[model samples]
Target: MDNLTLVIALAAVAVAGILFFINRRPARQTAVETVSHRRYAGAHREQARPAADADPQTRFVETSKPKQYRLLNSSEQELYHRLCEAMPNMRVFTQVGVSQLALARGRQEAMRLSRMAGRGVDFVVCDADFSIVAAIELAWPTTGQEIDNAEDVKRVALQSLGIPMIVFRPNKLPDADTISREIADAILRRNRLEAERS
Candidate 1:
């Protein structure tokens, strides 16, 4: 091959290597939730294991508490933070990447989390309400199914996976004020329940 052709081939290989690392890295620890009950049991044990700061902060908003768990645009985080604080003693972890399924060594991360849900996790938190609001205001489409169908899809997904989904919405969202409060409250509830000593 010519020098330019050789350079292009090297670049292609480098790009491929990077993609593989990203997809396969972290060694799929999160995906272990899909494989065995034992694995999920282990994960629950592990997930519940205290971080250095896992004391009073571990108390989560109960799952019954209303909250939407949708992902938000950057501009909305501050408002959401305030709303989260508005709840009595809520500490929220908002860093979840939509594409990042906590798993280990498998293509079936969703399945792992599905099983994990059965083990202990009662709710899946995604702030889908804003996405819905954004869809309505900007007329963008995020769901593969129609909104009603999409709602069913979401409900069914969690049911089959054995978890309730709490989609937290932005409090300052100009549209859909009613739904946003509902979703936020649901999420806040779950955040409180996770580490509560029964």
Candidate 2:
């Protein structure tokens, strides 16, 4: 066959192969991305633990001490407000602790917030996502000798880094002055410890 005929035949075969592959791919057969219900706290939480009973969270009750104020909401009472703040950012991360990423994120943020407790033992408000919020408030004495050790551990590594750190959670806070104080204190301590070690 002449070179022109050979070239034309090869082109035809190539075109046929392309068409065959395209036809084989059915658009309807495409994979569907399913959003898991695990993303919601009320639904997934009950299934996760029948005994823990987030019903206790029904009341946004406060456990006050001379040193700290912690609000408890196991039922996700605080979720509506907190979750809205996360939109376009980490909004999809509702019902923290249900997912590993949420837990990790909360711990990291809490580290910087640990500082404010010393300046003023105001309430440390965290949504139900951070169970520690309850512990910090109810567990500690509000007035005397109260130290936030949880935030301390979060910065154990920073003990040698001396990085100036700060924790800031945007959007509505249960109480601004108190929460900011906690965040600042935590960050300052982390910075101080790191400076001392370094």
Candidate 3:
């Protein structure tokens, strides 16, 4: 054979040898993976899907039943009534969001607004002109210290925007007369502070 023929034959032989080696090698086995409870639940749910052609048991039955719940519990309801009685001249709103009373400003407006949006006052007292006066938080007798700390954070955030937070324990609620006086005092104190700052 010519030199070119010899080179071609040698190349063909090398290619065949590589193919034979590849065919004779044992197939690699992938390790068995351990599935966690969470993952197994997800996989089982995926595998247990009903067939498309299978009949649905309750084709005409309505499964979603939504029920209404009271916005305030018994303690909160009592406080709401007391607030209304004490501040009859003013408007009292329940479950009020902090964002409604204070707006975020400056460079971090969105971030600040989001933080305020997540926090809310149990009750809000507003003047005749609809300006917010004070925020009231009713601390339940059975609450933990974490709730108290969270309330403190809310108080500081509201105070920063010139709004005062009044905390009243449900079990130790003051009478209407006392409540009215406390609100007046808080408003007066806030005004004095603002005047001094100005």
Candidate 4:
């Protein structure tokens, strides 16, 4: 071949080699990456899967029914019956959530209220119209430190909402008449305070 043809042929061969190298390098790298990814994925699956011979009982299974129990103890039951008898016209709800009794003004207040979701009054007294009259907490004669702290938090939250909370010790169970009178008085006082605000 002439010098120009020979140069062109050499150039073409170099270009082909360069292209082949470039393409082959990425293909090899990709193949390695694919193999590594598969291995990593297999390891993750092995870790996530239970052993083939694992016990059926050892596996976690959700139940349609959750564990059930009585909401109140014997003493609480006695107090609940008495309160019901005392206010025949009113509705007495057991384990009433504090959120139901209080109104949140904004998102911040609502989130704060959500934290109080599980904390509830032992008994909630409502009028015939379902307007909350007052909240009653059965304070045991012997209260644990944790219980006392929780009660204090509940008291503060109720007070902030302008709701009256009546704590009664089982040892000193008040007469139905006395409870009814106190509830009536509290309702009147609350009405007066709300009226003044308006």
Candidate number of the best TM-score: 3
lDDT of 2: 0.39
Root-mean-square deviation of every model: 24.6, 15.4, 17.4, 16.1
Candidate 2: segments with Cα more than 4 A from true spot: 1-174
For model 1, how does the per-residue alpha-carbon lDDT over 142-189 read when each residue is reduced to its tens digit? 455566465445444433322235433333343345545755654454
Off by over 4 Å in 1: 1-75, 95-109, 112-148, 166-198
For residues 151-193, could you state the per-residue lDDT of candidate 3 as single tens digits? 8788977776667888899789888998999899879866765
Assess every candidate by TM-score: 0.27, 0.23, 0.58, 0.56
Q: Which is the winner by TM-score between candidate 1 and candidate 4?
A: 4
Which pairs clash in the backbone of model 3? none
lDDT for each candidate structure: 0.44, 0.39, 0.77, 0.80
Model 3: residues with Cα > 4 Å off, grouped in runs: 1-68, 104-113, 141-144, 196-198
Candidate 2 lDDT over 48-137, as tens digits, reads 553545576664443454444434343233433433343222212222221232224356544544443232211223334532221121
Question: Is 3 or 4 the stronger prediction by TM-score?
Answer: 3
lDDT of 3: 0.77
The TM-score, computed over Cα atoms with residue i paired to residue i, of candidate 2 is: 0.23
- After superposing candidate 4, which stretches have Cα over 4 Å from the reference? 1-68, 103-109, 142-147, 192-198
Order of quality (TM-score): 3, 4, 1, 2
